[model samples]
Target: MRILESDGSIVDIFAIYWFGDETYFYGMPKNYGGLQAYKADEVTVIDNKIDFKTVFFSNDDAKSVHHWALIEESLLDDLLELDETAYKRFLDILKSEGQLDDNFY
Candidate 1:
């Protein structure tokens, strides 16, 4: 499992096999073009409340459309806590692979 933190919200990304069920992770990141078979599950809200749990990370060497080992899951933790330096490094990798663009938020 992989977690992305955007502001105070969290986005959960999982490979299909480990995802177990389809209730939360309904789709993949738009940039993936629906081919990578990974799911991005965003937090859901009811009224002014949000429902979610902090997910952790583990070491894995899964390859995607982009280059490998540039951004490693092992470097990230369960709280999805990436320091500014680490975040920038990860972002750079995404940008280099064209996974992030002007329209992404």
Candidate 2:
């Protein structure tokens, strides 16, 4: 997801997940394992206003999170170090994960 910042810059958010009372927001650059995990409470406010409980994705959504983590640990650093082949494989994995059809060649 893309968020428009207050400074008129566009930021890309890869994923967001919740665990217990915590909400994790992933939006860091690819080379840094951009996973930010935080807790949200009744007093927690965004845009300077309190909000109600936030619904989270189902348990199955964990698979996607796990996959991304694996990709980061296994490929992110290598790809950033100029490994073109690893980059290609990373793209393939992403395509496989996001593909809705069988044409993921």
Candidate 3:
């Protein structure tokens, strides 16, 4: 048996597998057309509300369209804790493909 975050929440971040930047990530409601990307030290973690006005940039530079959704911290912890085994396995796949780092919280 397997557990999941959502239909697109976890499915969207497979950057390396999709021939995209390993450092990039996707937000909720995962629409591939408006995917997110990052390079270098651009990825960040915040403990506040998702500022709808906030913008993220990638190697592409500037944005024509943006797609993101915020997942609450407590909810995030619950997901990780309850689904530890399956989550780790998914992370391992990313690690093997060089898309994720050990910094998962």
Candidate 4:
């Protein structure tokens, strides 16, 4: 899977697979979130790019988790080709929101 940045850059190489009744988003645990059923359809491919609409949850303690409503592919290509700064920013955002998995990064 790939994440497209605002500048149309792609980075963060990952894979998507199905196991039993759930869809797993592998790689960089903090940036990964598993989806099931209807949520899995959120990630779609369009124009050879990927898009996502994410829903976030937070508590008074400032911890949060986000569930992305995958959208049609955008213009992003290789997930590993993203600018280093951008990738770090992405990871930071995920970490700050407590959305990152323990195994991420």
Best of the candidates, lDDT: 2
The local distance difference test score of model 3 is 0.32
* Residue ranges of candidate 3 with Cα displaced over 4 Å: 1-12, 15-82
For all the candidates, what are their Cα RMSDs to the real structure? 11.9, 10.3, 15.2, 14.6
Distance from true position, residue 78, model 4, in Å? Answer: 6.2
C-alpha lDDT score of every prediction, in listed order: 0.35, 0.41, 0.32, 0.37
Q: Relative to the unseen true structure, what is the C-alpha lDDT of residue 99 in candidate 1, on a scale of 0 to 100?
A: 46
* Decoy 4 TM-score against native: 0.28
**Candidate 2 residue 51 C-alpha distance from true site, Å:** 23
lDDT of 4: 0.37
Which candidate leads the pack in TM-score? 1
Candidate 1 colliding pairs, count:
1
Candidate 2 structure quality by residue, lDDT tens digits, 1-96: 434444454333344556655655443233432333322232222332212122333664352243353344475455446566664575465556
lDDT of 3 at 34: 26
lDDT of 1 by residue, 1-105 (tens): 334434443332422223334323312243333212323344442222212222332335322221232224432332134255544555555566564564542
TM-score of candidate 1 relative to the true fold? 0.34
What TM-scores do the predictions have?
A: 0.34, 0.32, 0.25, 0.28
Query: Ten residues in a row with the worst lDDT in model 1?
Result: 45-54
